[model samples]
Target: MFELAKEFGGIQNPEIVVKLFSLTLMGQVGTSRFAICLKEGKSLYSKISGEYLETDKQTLFKLVSAPLLISELPDTKRYNILHDHLLKEKISALIPLQMQNEVKGVLCLGDKLRGGGYTQSDLEFIFSLSNLAFVSLENARLFNEELEKKKMESELLIAREIQQGLLPRTLPTIDGFEIAAENISSKQVGGDYYDAIPTDNNKFIITIADVSGKGTPASLLMANVQATVHALVPFQLALSIATARINDLIYRNTSSDKFITFFWGSLDAKSKKFQYVNAGHNPPFVMRRDGTIERLSDGGLILGIMKTIVPYQEGSVALNSGDSVILFTDGVSEAMDINGVDYTEERLESFVKGLNGKSASAMLSDIINEIQRYCTAAAQYDDITLIVFKAT
Candidate 1:
């Protein structure tokens, strides 16, 4: 380090900088030929007791003369005289670096067998070394930038995993009924969930909720709410009473500003009975075999909307064969396009009417696809959730 520092301290030429850097980084770099025009200035540097070649090229130009040292060549006597001048001042190169594509600059090292001229092997070695040096520097810069990007990506992936865990891993099985649900979030983590829990003897509970916000906070709150409901569900209770208690739990746990639009219900698979409460949520649609549509939007204020004032309302319906109920979050209704119009309830009702001909899975897939197409090119701002219940 000290040797290079001393050599560099006495060096003062554009080409000398590259010579010093290459030598320091790559072991032994000889023959200083440099030039890369940057916003700072023209850069060309080299080493000492060496011939300094000066040229008028403002930019990097191809080396017209190859393997000729300024000190030995008599043709460019002006270069020889200039080399003498720069050497007196310890300047490494009086010449600027020039290159068009490859073979940008030239520097003649001493010949192998005496000092006739540089051999082809020596020239090849120098060229290879310089190329390696240039590539190494470029690679280092790119690698660092990529490393930072990967770190950010890692953080996002971890967040996504955690968010995913908050959702129901498996739906609860109920006798004499077919139930299935799915949710897809925009690239970032979101606040949407569905859960199946047993509420009482012969009673299977279903919940589809949309928490008000996104990211880690919403996911965390959803987890908290799920735990609370699951813990309370094991006890047999009336639909309204259970929802009221659940709302209080949520209100107590989260801030007044944060709330969830939730729909909760219990289905008696054997009896074909459905009882549910809609807390300021999208109404669940019941499609009968005769092509009749039933909107179940009976509940009161959404959970976390008030500390204790509003009471939750309850409703019930009977499901026979060929009957299906669709429950979803606001993502489907509020979905809009460049025109800024939503996929309103009327459109959704028409979609349900259209899908009466399709099977359960097909109907679900088609509805989601239709909504996505409606909002073409518009980034989805919320989680899209769908739960379809068919009486088998």
Candidate 2:
């Protein structure tokens, strides 16, 4: 068995070694009552059969370390660990497969079938076999680990592709308004979303939301919200009803950790009336023609926080010529600079009022640029987004 294990171990193909070990074990047990315990003190493998047969690593480790496990083995002092006892008996190659200061496994051959204990020669043979087997096992383990890593990488790439496609590929055009939105996703996916939903003629619904958290779980919840809104919009239901259905759908579909701060509004082309609802979101700021600012904040609870919520009350503001509406995520107000001061709502208001007569696109760009300027050396804390509606 020792010579055969040595030959098989040298072969790069691990399957051949596995088969040899099994075949050897079957032969050993056939006619002898002798025990050929492996160096690791695992059950003896018969040379006649090529199989693992009966070796549990967990159980073997317990046997080697006393007091660590509940073992029924007798406390007889006569029983010695495979290596220590075999060395004392003078085996030629006690395959201290264990390296210097390293615990390579051990192999212990036992006495003859009808006899008392293992002879010196038998022990030497088993020691040789253990050294060879360790190399084979280590190689097999490394191969399996590499295989698993590649599999995970493939799946993650696919998940990222699907996420990108589902998001808005292009911003919708609003006749007299220039709008821009961005979702700088984290390494993990996010449920945070933005959209420019088309409503009646010349009227479009602009929305932005931070859906609780990030990742596959959040992405799934966001998908539900997008699907529900698109399906309900064509019916032209009241904003309150639309919100109500959305809330119910979210609450019923997700866990407690899942919720969304959503903001949506309809922009009337000729009337210049911006009707909006703020469902626990960062309010949209309107820079009035008179240089006064109004934070459009009237709606209901964040969706999915609970099973039922008060109808999202509709809020409206009539935009006079030259006024602009700025809708954003909390990421804006919360944006911090190197000094640790946040770019608060108060600052944003004063900043926009400064650009009173700017074009819609310019205002949007200016606002974003302002954030970057204010944040100076600090990175964005959350997903920063913005949309501008200009009453021309």
Candidate 3:
């Protein structure tokens, strides 16, 4: 027994321990046939020298409480199924591998080669051996699980860094325009993206998008959208035509279930003309100098649903001094309170009406603060993003 314990303790691999345990039991009990069964995840795993019987964990747990001959089980309806199976497989004895009064596995042994039944001492020793092996196997499984968890956490950190790098580091300083944007991920990585790029002829582009889903997959797709937008900027295509091409590219590359709610506009500082496309995104509120608000919603379907069947239509808005455009993802509008009630778009519009003369940065900060106050201690369930640009 001491030698067997020493041997098991020396091995770190569970598979090797199981094999050695089976061989030791066969040699010690003078049997040619043996089987070791262990539970792995939702399935049964068995190692046998000869034929094996397929039995579930529930059946084994209910039948085997201690070491005993298979024939000793009551010949009733309750034990009939397991009894018949053991008999057919030539298994004569059952030893349970238990820890903390719970059965973790079972050891089955065939008849002695000399045709004699196993004594009580032999059964006791087999039970002890089986438990020792089970402890080693469980330890190995737990170690592997911990290692996998650490690996996933490390990968997520890298993904978060990459996702953040794709966002604009500094908002372009367009003359007569004050712009401020912020994104807060609900997890280590998210799908929300925003950017401001300088273009030709005293003009610049402002873009914001919310890709479906979250985590690594969503972040990767967000990166793809950013890349596509940057690559097409030099072409200077019409807003409507450029939007259609982007939709087709996203549809061909991503699955049908994946799509992005996108809003982008080219603002000309000299003309004060904003030509934009709203691809099924939340319509940005164009609050004029007065209290009146206009929603920019004229465009085609969201990107990646299918090839652009209908050409994207452009929407033009003339921004005057003191006018502001507020754009946001649904995360902000659908943010839930502790009572599960959403802070809807109506509340946002009412709040904006009170901030007619505030700077872009102040407006953005105040809106985020209001949302945080409304949500209170409730956990954020999605990414929150906002972009506020004012014509100064």
Candidate 4:
């Protein structure tokens, strides 16, 4: 048995090892037939057919884990059910296959060819053989799991690359204005996005959006939004009309449960007038040089929720020399600390209210630093996106 244990440990194919061990067991115990059942995902499988063999697998599993002598429990209901369902083809002893203190499978053998029950010594030998088979099977399972994990990680890396490429590498320089935007995604790819496009006139368009969900699906939807905005903005469409078109496109393209909170606007360099619409997004704050704050909140429903029911209302504001507009996703306002308290919108407004004199880029950096400080030792759960546009 010790020599056979070494041979079983060397076998690479777990299925082949199981079959070989069963044959060897039948020879030693003089059993008529032998069979092995192994756990696969949520169920147990045997060689009865290509599909799984339907039986009470959980009960059989529990029986093998503890000390059970079938001959001593003839009157028990559980023993009767297990015996009737499992011990077919004249099978007698059922031995447990264990690895790392966990039962991985079961080994069954028919009644002895000598027409008698197995001795105590014979049962112990069967246990040793089952353990040898389990070690080989567990090794194969772990190797396959590692391979699958590596494959998934490689796919996620590719997805992150594509999402990063869609973001602006450089903010389009509009005369008489300073613009800065930043995005810090969580470990899982988040759907936060921002962009700036320079039009034919001195005017340009700026946009910030957050698609629901994350990973490859959200990134793909964001790419679609980018393509749609770039295509329609050049047509000289009004902000309201353009927003309606975007809503229709997203609603038709994705499922009902998926949606995007969006804000976009056109800025006139010569007139210093900003025309915009906010579609169920977190209202952006426009801090005036007079210390008064204006919230942009006049647009229709969120994109992809349903088709445009009514024309999206457009809003406009005139910017002064020292005024700044702050655009952010919920990630900044909803950042959680170790104690699960959100940083909150009030904190963000207070932080920016005192920074009315800083440069656009400096203000962006300081806010991110404050967020990191507040959420110390806690993992970021959502994507953080910020855009600051100041009338210089």
Candidate 5:
């Protein structure tokens, strides 16, 4: 019996244990056919053929307290009921396979092929063997589950590295300007992206965008946006004309459901003028030196929604010394607290007012710290992309 138990322990497939149980018992105590009925969602699967009956799982719960012998159970008693299931199938022994004091499955053995009843010693031996096999089967299931989880975590880490490589490694040093940007993802690789590309003649193109989805799909789409922007912006094309072409390209290449909220601008140090377009993005706050604020609300529909639905409108602002621009994704304004309340736009506007004369880097750090304090250690649920550009 110990040798048979050891053999069952080495088997990974749970169903194979039932077939082996039938063969091993036939030699010892004349039991022949066997079946394993396991819980499948709300139903019960009684065989290896994948057949299941539409029944409440509570019916199986009744067998957890003890093993049942078909001949010994009184058919007329309400508490000893088998529902005539075993009698109809000619099963002589039913053993509960338990783990953590809960029955995870049942082992059923039919009448002997030679036509004899199962003795008390035969029933006890089968019960012990079923428990041994249950341990092996449960361990195998948990081992596979752990392996799959590790594989997924490794893949997400790789995706995060690739996404980081896509962003600007170092911000371009533009004369008369101080710039800094940060992307703090919410425990996942997300769609928030920011770039500061140096264009011709001491001019710089700055952009911040958010893709429509989460994880790998969002990161891939953000990469596509970066590729498009890099390809078109260097041509010194009109901001509106270049933006329209980007919309058309994205519309043709991707499904209609995918879109990007984008905002990009070109700053010319000589002119100290910023030309920009905002494509259905969160309006950026332009905080002036005098503590007055301006929200950049230019451009048209989000990219990839349709091909040139509305001609993108170009907007410009003349930057004076001490003027600052704050750009961020919805992740900043929509961050949630432990109580599920959002850190809203009104709070953000008030916070920016307090840091009226701070440097770009200091302002960015303060904003992130305030957001963390508001959340009170609640897990961030989205990507926080921030950019601070100030005229020196």
Candidate 6:
């Protein structure tokens, strides 16, 4: 016993421990054939040598609790099935591997090679050895799980850094325009994106998008969108043409399950004209100084669903002084309260109507505060992103 304990103390691999335990049991019991069955997570691990037996793990676990001869089993329907199976495989005895009164596994042994039945002393030794091996297997499983958890946490921290880098460090200071934007991710990394890029002709580009899912895959796709937008902005193509190109690239590269809701426009400060395209995105509200609202809704389908079947349509709106364009992802509108009701779009529009004279940054802050107050106790389930452009 002391030698067996010393041999198992240093091993951490479950498979190696099982192999050694099987060999030791066969040698100690003077048996040529044996079977070891242990439960691992949601599945069963079994090892058999010398003779093949079709063992039902659930049945063995349910019926066996103590050491007993297979021939001496009670003649009930359940026990009869196990008895017949053991006899067919020439198995003679059953010993349960237990820890703290709970059965963790079962060990089956065939008749001794020299022809006598197993005694009480032999059964006791076998039980003790089986439990010792089980303890080692459980420890190894726990250690591996901890290592996997740490690896995932490290990867998520790196992903968060990369996602932050993709956002604009400081929005461009466009003449006669006040711009403010904010993005708050959920517990996990999300795919909400917003950017403002300056162009050559006294104009700037404003874009916001929400990718379909969350986590590393979504962040990776968001990075691709950011790269594509920057690469195409230098050419100064029409909003319609650039949008079509982006749609085709995404569709050809990604699978059917992936897509993005996107909205973008070029704001010419001198002309005060905003030429925009909305690709299945939440239609941003153009709130006028007189409390009127116009929703920008003209465009093609969302990106990456399919190829650009029809050319995207472009819409243009002239921004007057005191007019505010409010853009946001679904996270803002779908935010829940303690009663599970959403802060709907109608509420958001009404709230914006009251903030007519507020600065762009103040409007952004008030909206964020309202959403946070509304969802005081409920957990946030998605990314919240908002961008406001006010004509000065």
**Number of the top candidate by lDDT?**
6
> 26-75 in candidate 4: lDDT tens per residue?
67766635556667553223333312224655566777773234564356
Q: What local lDDT score does residue 180 receive in model 1, on the 0 to 100 scale?
A: 78
Compute each candidate's TM-score over C-alphas. Answer: 0.61, 0.61, 0.84, 0.82, 0.86, 0.84
| Candidate 6 residue runs with Cα over 4 Å from true position | 1-10, 30-63, 85-91, 104-116, 290-292, 335-347, 350-356, 374-379
| Candidate 6: residue 236 lDDT (0-100) | 94
Tens digits of per-residue lDDT for model 1 on 214-245?
66777777777777778777776777887888
Name the 10 consecutive residues with the lowest summed lDDT in model 5.
Answer: 48-57
User: How far does residue 249 in candidate 5 sit from its true spot (Å)?
Assistant: 2.6
Segments of candidate 3 deviating more than 4 angstroms: 1-14, 30-40, 47-56, 74-77, 105-115, 289-292, 334-357, 373-381
> Which portions of model 2 miss their true places by more than 4 Å?
1-160, 335-355, 370-382
The whole-model lDDT of each prediction reads 0.67, 0.64, 0.85, 0.81, 0.81, 0.86
Model 3, 1-392: lDDT tens per residue?
88888888777776787688768876787775666665554222343433335444467766788998987988789878777778777788988978788887677777787888989998998889888887777776777788888887777776677678999998988899899999887754668899989999999989999999867888899999999999999899998999999999999999999999999999998888898999999999999999788999989899999898789999999999999999999999999999999999999999988888899999999999999999999988888899999999
C-alpha RMSD by candidate, in order: 11.5, 8.7, 3.5, 4.2, 3.2, 3.5
What alpha-carbon RMSD in Å does predicted model 4 have with respect to the real structure? Answer: 4.2
Which tens-of-lDDT digit does each residue in 1-392 have in candidate 2? 65675576566555665555444533642222212334443343432221221332223333432111112334555333433443343322212344343544434233334544444554454444544565665565566668777775565455455556656888777666666666554444556667778877777777777777755666666777777877887888877778888898888878887899998877777687888888999888888777788888899999889865466799999878778788877777788999888899888878888888887778878888898899887866565767776777
Candidate scoring better on lDDT of 5 and 6: 6
Worst 10 residues of 4 by lDDT: 44-53
Q: Can you rank all candidates by lDDT, best first? A: 6, 3, 4, 5, 1, 2
Ranked by TM-score, the better of candidates 4 and 6 is: 6
Candidate 5 lDDT, 90-114, residue by residue in tens: 6677778787887877776777778
lDDT of 2: 0.64
Index of the highest-TM-score prediction = 5
* Backbone clashes counted, model 2: 23
